[model samples]
Target: MADLLHSVYVADKGLIFKVSGYSQNLHLVVDLVTREMRAASGRVDRHMFEAVREVRARSYHNVLLKPHKLSQDVRMNVLIEPYISVRDKVSLIQNITLEELQDFTDRFLDKLYLQILMQGNIAWTDAIKISENVLKNIKWEGLPEAESPVIKVHQLPLGDRKLRVMSLNPASTNSIVTNYYQGEVATVNDTATLEVLMMLMEEPVFDVLRTKEQLGYSVFNLVRYTFGVNGFTITVNTQRDKFTVSHVDRRVESFLKKFSKDMNRLSDKGLAAVKQSLIQLKHTTDYELKEEANRNWREITSCEYKFQRLLIEAEAIDKVKMSDIRKWVADHFAVGNKSRFRKLSIQVVGHLPNSADNATQGESGVQDHSLQLLHAGQPSTNIQENQEEFITSIDDFKKSLPLVNTPRVELAQC
Candidate 1:
């Protein structure tokens, strides 16, 4: 809601729309505008016009002067959308003096910049000035004619590619890797595209690279669930010892080059297997009850992706052709992975596999003395799936354990 309000707020002036009739919602809406909240929504009130003008002169707008690329402008795709009539609005519950409005607007813009735009790559100070200038100078021209996005990957030759995942969306994390991977063109957005892309990698990446070859402990193929709560990420966790981050990176590149699916689509047998695997993973064997609770918690906490895992039938993905997968990867996974954080952080105590040399203690700098191993190539962590799994607490362990009744309330949050 806050994001929508911000987009609307930054789009131009204050929003103005009339409902068939609104009763108690008017005051509530006005309160939000006055606060200058992000993506906030409210009813249009008499004072909102003045507020918009005030914000224009005061708060920074995130107007993109050259937004053609983001909106698929190259393909000549233009979006003309209708205004939605909102029933809710912000209310000015606190006594905000008019004298404070201008300063508040400036503060509001500052908060917005800090909250969203500063990706740690850029300094806050620099972003502030840039945002201010961009907002102030924007011509506010009408929406541009949408066109096809630049097909950067489509131009790649067979030899030039490394690894690729199909269409990546900025809204997702895997899209980030998909782009950073080989030259595969990624066609990503919403659910359909993301699902197809994920299905293609789901087994091959896991069985071949992670399980068989032992690439990274965390290296398991993943299908993204973007429908409910937009999601995308496929992590490969390994210690630093086995492969320099660079070596794994290169291997993935090589793997992508050879793993082409231009001819054969997912076979019915493949689809059925994938479907069965998915079903197996979905139902928590009564023993995996904590898993169920954890899922429920996520669903309750975030409105997105709660029912999504249950909703999508994985069998639907079997129809995706190998060509589609290749093209998608080629497009989205071709570039831009330097953006992620690699703090080289080490928590002194975490889940180190029992196989680790426990006798060894952290030296002045463990980066050297401590071995770093990738999950795939390294020996198993000596973990037993049958053993008591780690949950938030023993209570959670019972929640996940196969049983008829909930665990006694002896233990609390851990």
Candidate 2:
């Protein structure tokens, strides 16, 4: 008889498999190996192939035609190492034959280890029986576990800045600009600090850039953690008919520079209030059953199995002083700290009446002056003088920053 195994051990180190649901509900994820082995047995027919092609084509078109998706793709390409897109996947799908996919799936499947996770109301015996029943149908011969993929986290080089303008929807008048600041590798403490800082900055950023300056309709500031790397971004979605990307960039910089002064004035009482609000939010027992499971699943998937991470963060937040928050802001946004500051700016420009001419005018009038101030290497009376200088070319931007040796995520071999 096939083995019906159930073993309990601490997952000290390894890749994660996540399952989310209520305690009474069962969730099963057939590992890639088993799924691919089944696929390799030639289950895919011509109809399935055509269906997949059509689905992928539609997805590619949606991404291409949607301005928000296009802007998100630009942001991801800038942030992710060895950037690959849905378009690239679609291209690959179009180029490969069904037989090729089967072969490739077989080879790739041979290189992956299997993981099984049971949560909620499932009993150990039930899990064992389920696993056994699933495996009984597959051709796997209890092969030894294969290695896991290595996911490399990309680090933005210090002092280097990148600017990308992706044009999408030539007929749409709306444009978007996103500025990303490369932050330190995430730790519980640092992540907590950044979260509080974002809370402090969010309203002011919007009030100044959106309401007061009238730069755009949508203005947002938030902390973003990609893989294990932490960063913060300020995004504005405006109309090319009214404003250009350069103008938005300038206004954002101006707000941030002045915000530094505001940071200094953030009284102990103000800091305390923010911390209390965050603590209250974290301590709120508002998790539904599924929400709780999903939160645990995220912890497992991120390899930070502190199921009570919010509590841990709350404790960290308690110890965070106003000085700590100021230091973090200074380290990231301070002028002349070239070795510690890096930014990536992505602009999605829309088509409108003489938009190209307006964009040039904006760039020359705003960006040229800013660049000149940066090149002068002298303190300027302007509030935006401390902003990171933008580089037009990706290659030049990469050259200015130090690269981290984070391992690239790759398929592992058996």
Candidate 3:
């Protein structure tokens, strides 16, 4: 049983059941899984407490990582996903009985919208046979296509907002600051522009933030699409001993200000070179069948169904003008354009004597084109008490902000 059962895991999106063995043992593995799913015995096992402790430890470690902690906060507050924090999980699990667990599992499995992906040397007919056996054993009602649950992300409000939370690891001296620039509704063209911008900013950002400025060892950027609503983020993991979270946040803004200027100096030939490189990257061949299958499965899961996204994006990149990139930066990031842009800043401040500075004191820094370049990352060491700009209550802040109503992806007509 141990050899045949690979693992069972759960994430924010969904649960996954995995098994592995020889092709001859495939039926046996499926049968074992089906029986387990069908049996909902409301019997408590004392031995399972050890496993619970392990899970709790892992969750604790996950939240301890500043970046992961910041991401969880953003999803819960900005995206409005009801995520269970590590502390909450511990309390909930302690009070939960086996009967409650069994009831919850039964209710969860009562109706299902199953998505299966089969790879390797399995034939189509054999795959269908395996799927049928599992479905028959489960004996669950399939959810209607229209009624299937879709992941929804709340639209961030226009203008700048900041969420500053103390870091989970009190012993650790490192802090993380992430500034997310939310774009308009998701489109292939806009996504392509973001990809190009991030790529261009990648080397320069590392050079300026980590190498030259010495902010932190880990400084990077990401292109994020929450439930297909486009956005991008720039993050810095700096130590509170050297600088406060407020200072790091300001420096991040300062980098964007400098990067914006660099974009204007960019010539047509330079932009073309970057575009061509991106095109070549898109056309790169998959190393194996698994890679291709995983790519397609991602599309299926997201409901994007854009299997040829890479090629489509490549074409869009070819059409992208230097003006498009410049305008995108200016529209979303330029100072004095607060009414037009929507920005969310998440700061996970570490526990240290110097780390307790006001997270929202540097609103004026965004407009300052020239500052002490050497000492700019260092905010006044004097700890401020008042921080009205910081989002103290997430619920109150979100009450007035409008949600982004992104249109659903329609299935292609046959």
Candidate 4:
């Protein structure tokens, strides 16, 4: 029932460790959690793998303990690390027959060879061959057969002795899908997003809150994403101004519609460029063998392997029209009130209101409180901060500056 598992793992039943096995050529870091375990980095080997193996083997729940550092005996010091209880040592027990242990260890060492090939300091074509071999050798029971293009490759080509490749398949709607299967939502928060933000600020949230009700500038209109979860997320920060509870709802609804309509006007070239850039990113990073291994394992256990076909599908993406993108945005990305969303949090940075019509909402029609807060908070503020603040009239400001701080050259008006 845990989300991620950060405990240690052993293929040969703790006899062989897969850490530092790669030396400096590769590094594999694993942070196992409940229900899910994450192992990443380059390749690792026996000695370093032993260290990681020990840390995980000696953990109490999630806290790792170094077995060697426990006590002086090295023998007696085995299980005395901090936060470790003797009862927690029960997981270390192994009941396999020596034959079973030997076979498991053989499998571990065999896979370690493949690990070098897949995660080794090697070439892409060579690594691909190694990956195919790794898959062939590390067959666990009930694992579905891997088809052609069994891997979705993410590669980074550097013109050096060490070439790199990174790939993940996202087949599951959950675990290892991005690594083992295909599907992700790439949002465009570029100039277009900024333009949208500016337009949405049309009825500046401040007016809606202070003029009608009151709120702070904690007002936000974002096109965000849930960390590794698929989908686009929009968040509205409502601290700057306090709005009538109903007005907040209505404004959010209105803003979404306008955003969608604008998206409908996006140039085809722009959309295509963004999509292409995302797709091209598939080739930017190199793959480490451990990632490939865990990703495959996760897919076999938690996702589907067919996700390897993502890149091709993505490359063959349909030429999207402005209307199509707009509809897609509205369907998947818009921020209207829905079951997936809620008023996440409403934080008022300045003085907050205790009343339901929150004291922060201010007198029904109070002048801009920010301006008021400004004057009230600092009576001796600087004049440069003002947009139209000047001792002289516009004409006088232009002429009089000659005496104050005139430019040396005959400055041309921009």
Best by TM-score: 3
Candidate 4: deviation at residue 104, Å? 24
- For candidate 3, give the lDDT of residue 193: 91
Return model 4's CA RMSD, one decimal.
Answer: 25.3
Q: For candidate 2, write residues 196-261 as lDDT tens digits.
A: 999999899999988998888889998988777788999998986787677777778788889888
What are the candidates' C-alpha RMSDs?
Answer: 21.9, 9.0, 7.8, 25.3
Candidate 1, TM-score vs. the true structure? 0.31
Selected candidate, larger lDDT, 1 vs 4: 1
Across 1-414, the per-residue lDDT of candidate 1 in tens digits comes to: 222222232221123221111323432343444344422322334377467644543221111111211112111111111111110011121234444655554444442211112222446676565545444432233332242111111111212211211111111111112212222122223343445556556666777657876755656444433112222334454443353333454455555444444213446565456545554554436465335544554443332332454434333343444444444554444231322211110101112234333234445321221112223212233322222111122122223323112122111221
How many residue pairs clash (N, CA or C atoms closer than 3 angstroms) in each of the candidate models, in the order given? Answer: 72, 7, 0, 48
Give the winner by lDDT.
Answer: 3
lDDT score at residue 124, model 2, on the 0-100 scale: 90
User: Per-residue error at 93 for model 4, in Å?
Assistant: 24
How many Å off is the CA of 127 in candidate 2?
A: 2.6
Stretches of model 4 off by over 4 angstroms after superposition: 1-118, 121-230, 237-251, 287-301, 306-310, 316-323, 329-414
